[model samples]
Target: MVSTTSKWTWKSPGDETRNQIDCMMISKRYRNALLLAKTYPSADCYSDHVPVVGKFKLKLKKNSKPFTNIKFDLAILKTNQTIRGKNQISVQNKFEALGDAEEVEQQWKNFKSAIMEAATEVIPKVKRKAKQKWMTEEILNLMEERSCSKGNKEKYEQIHKKVQEKCNMSKENCINEKCKEIEQQRKHAPQTMYSGFA
Candidate 1:
């Protein structure tokens, strides 16, 4: 292939000519999410054409469900007698204060509001925690290294192998940990285990 400073996407082996023939096509909807799209010539794919990598920073919209966010930790009510009693008293007082509504719908709304208000006042909210992922920081770093060393075939290949190995090991470890957790739950809290499946 013809040696040049500029990056080329493809190289004709027989003719020793290089050209940027490959292109990336993305939807207009996700145009803003496209951070970078480029070709890496040193990537050892054992082919005339190089790989085109596209980096995206996607802002996914969360699924909106009715009354999903205001989840009160009901488990606390089961464990703490004081909180349960307070909640009961609060609901009773609210219901009494609500009086009689003219319509059935209004009465139902009032009842629902009363129960929600009482729960909000007495029960602690369930804190939304980020879901745990199988991918580890070490694996991520290795991937980053591989991306960075894409200009050097030897370095890229080395890091790529390491990334694959780390990914497999991490996935296996995550699976084993989950299995152990399930076993423990099955032994100690069989009801909870069954409920999880349901």
Candidate 2:
């Protein structure tokens, strides 16, 4: 017999008795891994039924995939004209030098390796940060204010409007900045730039 704190999992309004509507069961083999199972009424699930949570103690296997990953600086490929041109030429020369092969798959592998080597040499890799630059201080502050005023609907609505306005402004700024960057790249690297209509 399994011993538990509360016997019933659910209850009805009109009915005088409550019944066990939920249960946590484990197989005989994993019975020892079962840690605890209980119900909490103050979990704020917005329902008549309380929340039931269970904890387990089991060992998990680690993933076999390597943690480190090779990163390439693709941004330079478009922005730098010299590196881009030289890298393309190098890749073409390497592919031509490879000549014909017996298997088509082997030929493709050789071509791919040549291109990868050229990219690694011409384009340096840089680590990127996880944080977003577009998330301005005003937006973060407004979000904090909105969260703090959760119970007050009027205040929350006012803050929400301000947050929306700030978000729109931030989006516009980001677009303008990107446009400026593209303009700069086009002006500096005219040879690489293409007229889309042409």
Candidate 3:
């Protein structure tokens, strides 16, 4: 059994990794019998760790048999008729308190806002390369046609510049100095782009 109250439990996994709770592995070097409840004391606090629980008396054999060390590896099964009846009533009240459609809609909006912050604000953007990369013509066309906000357009363009750098490409070939007749370039010196960066 594992303690639920232990805060040093779940290790924050990397982005794009599957969401999985940390599992509690039983110790294998035991010389004697081991009880489930005896191993894990804070069973009520852990929301994920304790996979099993129960209330049963031990009936250990005198002989050291295999798998006999585990004294009941299961949760206590309760089937009280009165408790079930009360639970139905409680569940109905809980559902009723959930309010109506408008509240649910607002909740959905809040969820969307959270998703945006997590994906956009928190996670560092990683640029990927395409074998058939979008040419300047395609990008220019996209800029002219896309209906995103100006801020979003600028952010996306910056990300694109980083992506270009990752593929060992540069715009130095395109940027001609002091050629006003052709397209006038920006004043700032172009900076180098880095890996996994945006």
* TM-scores of all candidate predictions against the true structure: 0.35, 0.33, 0.18
Whichever of 2 and 3 has more TM-score, that candidate is 2
Output the better candidate (1/2) by lDDT: 1
Model 3, span 70-118: residue lDDT tens: 2221121144555445444554454445444467776565555444333
Q: Which 10-residue span in candidate 3 carries the lowest summed lDDT?
A: 68-77
Could you tell me how far off, in angstroms, the CA of residue 98 lies in candidate 2 after the best superposition?
5.0
Error of 1 at 191 (Å): 37
The sequence of per-residue lDDT tens digits that candidate 1 reaches over residues 59-172 is: 998868664457789999889999999999999899889999999999998999899999989889875442447777777667767877979999999989998898788788
Ranking by TM-score: 1, 2, 3
TM-score result, candidate 1: 0.35
What candidate 1 gets wrong by more than 4 Å, as runs, is 1-68, 133-198
lDDT of 1: 0.80
Off by over 4 Å in 3: 1-102, 133-198
